[model samples]
Target: MHSSSRLFPVALVSAELRGDLTEDVYRLKPNNSPDPSVELALTRLGLPGREQRGAPVILVHGSFSNRRFWYSPRAIGLGPYLARAGFDVWIPEMRGHGLSPRNLDYSRNSVAAYARFDLPAIAAFVVEQGGQAPHWIGHSLGGTSLAAALGGGYLAPEQVASVALFGSQVSRDYWALKLPPVVWSGRFLLKRMGVIPGPRLRRGPEDEPIGLALEALRWYGLFGRFGERGNDWWAGLAEVRAPVLAVSAEGDRQDPPWACRKLFEQFGSEVREYLCLGRRQGFSENFGHVEMLVSKAAQREVWPQVLHWLERQALPLQANGAGGAAQGG
Candidate 1:
């Protein structure tokens, strides 16, 4: 039993052993006083016998994804990879995704809501349990939300030891979405459906609410800014002080390398590193969006580099190759 679970309004849903690792699942009540209900689930993994593991690292899945994206039931992927390396790995399945049950306002889920509410709760919880600031790794929209959390000041700088944004960028321009008529039309159509079927759309394994789609309206629409009600997250990114690493893939058409770089440059952190998962960076091949992290190539190539980043907080020695580290942690 986890001490945090016993102290907080949380339930130990399950405790399973997978080979040498232990997986503990917890269901937490919403930390919001107004919405004192359920919101999300966390899957924790750690070496069972280790008296003192490394620092905690929280992995946030992107849009149309869940905890399984980080750590599958078969005990594969980055979550387990970090766990085996003695890092306290935590995977959070956002509302209505994976182990998390949707609340009544399920259809109203948005990045703003996630940044302002869910992440704060998560950060507080992780700090409480791990007794230290946790490093954050987010994929795609997961990365975007984490950016929003930091930019909007919802997540304090001291609460974060470091942050890694994989395949994440908000600077990509959508000309069509910028038009008022187009934004209105798209919102109308999405509202009628309420949710986007991820599998049907061939996006991923999970479904997304209509509210998430409205981000384009806020970001690319008339007088667009990456925020709502006059809150500008894009400008806010300049205030972030945590050590930051931003990764972009050459083959990612969704969030191109240029745009990813643009977002990376927004961070005001004195310590910032930008990595490109492409041949130009000396990797074996030009890595695609999903393949950059989820493919077998990533397992063999990219994972070690990421693990090195988390462990050492330094940029990889890309000249050496995929599994290359910069002569340190």
Candidate 2:
């Protein structure tokens, strides 16, 4: 069995996640000694200097993942890459994930809850801690929640400098419209393999049972899968006036490249960028949704594009890409 303790120096004090991916990052928790203070947690690298001009970027991981996913070593992952690219980066641990408090009844939660409770809390916490809004980036469900929270007034327009979304959808109606059988198949396989458990990541006195988070939300095997949608996030997407970047993977089954493209086209931002990572980019033979962040080719080719886009968006009117020392761990 994997050790329950954190393997990294920067990790949250009490956070206990499997050390498979998040071995190098530190976890950020809310200030202690407050009533109802189950605020979201943040795992960060690259502390900001006083001389920094841009707002820090906060990262939100998708369902079934906490801050650790961003630190996976198979690929250079987003946290370190963005840090090296000259931005202060933070990855949030949403409610019931990693070290954050768990819900008494997991059934009482919804995707909207994460947007309303988790994202807003983290955004407020960032401002309170850093005294400024942040450039937010999210993956899959993470992006969906941030978009919804911002649109819903949980996050003010000024609190967010910009947003970057990867492989995410923005509508409740999207489930029936897209998604292949393989997604369902994967869920079934995982369940058959006994991976379905509650949302908490910390192991209990006994070994923690495997759990299904994203696909387990709905009884029909679809509605509750991605997240609370349409109004929750789409409402936020429509209300958001900030600049946005939407990224999609060419052969992704969960949220297809077309979905990301559609989201960018529908957004109100005048300065939006859309990217489609294809097999030609070396993402992989079948680069499924999660592999992009863990593929070396994606680190070499795709990550730089995201970093450059972030720099340009942060500075305004600047459009240039810079190369990084793409080394493997």
Candidate 3:
């Protein structure tokens, strides 16, 4: 394949046909990458032999996870769900995860770097191809990076149609991490360990660099802020103007619903909605962090609602009837 495009120097890595969908994987070279070794992998999924009728959507996975979080080899998961619904679904694997090669300084890769370098490049490529702004859906730490990008001013509001975050949080209190001695000790151990093994831990297939853990701890340290250098991302969240949706699961102890809701409240977007997946919210059952979107219940109850949100910028009537509010975007 003569793969590189004119708008961006993305190289086509592979193409596979999965049932009714055509999957195209592209390698994106970051512009002014913090680590020159970084090259991102974006997998695009669409209907085969037909033009897509819906706008583009980007699915971002969280820490210690990969593209498989949103897709699988058998044409399963949310990426395929959106593709089948006529949405151009694209999934991006963060540096050193999935098809993306590890950076030379992989141990030091952090969310700040991803927000600053990777996401802008991705939005540019998708916009050029889709001929319009794309919607973004992120899970866990991926959502944190998305929020950081919008808060850090790397992504302009007009560049995206909407933003959705699942199982992501920053406001939850960690009293132990607030202490200096504990923070220092934790950081020391993490640096020595280097990386967190995903499979052994049963989190996912990709191992995450220790820098991600260190970054999280530092944010909870005494007087620590969420931004690098002197920037304050918490304060900057008030500057984001794009419509936002934050989804939380009742059983997600890792990122509890309260914390997720608090994070959503920080966003200054005038058009914003908060959703909780649980019996209280009329879901079949309370969802956990990983299964919130991966399970069959989500396929039956949540997926259609996601499509509704992308198309309408508002929650469905039944969602409001149950406890979820509709702040109509």
Measured by TM-score, the strongest candidate is 3
Q: How far is candidate 3 from the true structure (C-alpha RMSD, Å)?
A: 1.6
Candidate 1 segments exceeding 4 Å error: 1-8, 318-329
> Number of clashing pairs, model 2?
12
Number of the top-ranking candidate, with lDDT as the measure: 3
Candidate 2 segments whose C-alpha is farther than 4 A from its true place: 1-39, 47-54, 73-76, 171-195, 198-236, 279-286, 314-329
Q: For candidate 2, lDDT tens digit of each residue in 40-101?
A: 55665553333553457888888677766776533347776776666666777765677555
Question: Measured by TM-score, how close is model 3 to the native structure?
Answer: 0.96
Q: What is the C-alpha lDDT of each candidate?
A: 0.84, 0.58, 0.87
Give the 10-residue window scoring lowest on summed lDDT in candidate 2.
Answer: 320-329
The TM-score that candidate 2 achieves is: 0.67
Clashing pairs counted in every model: 0, 12, 0
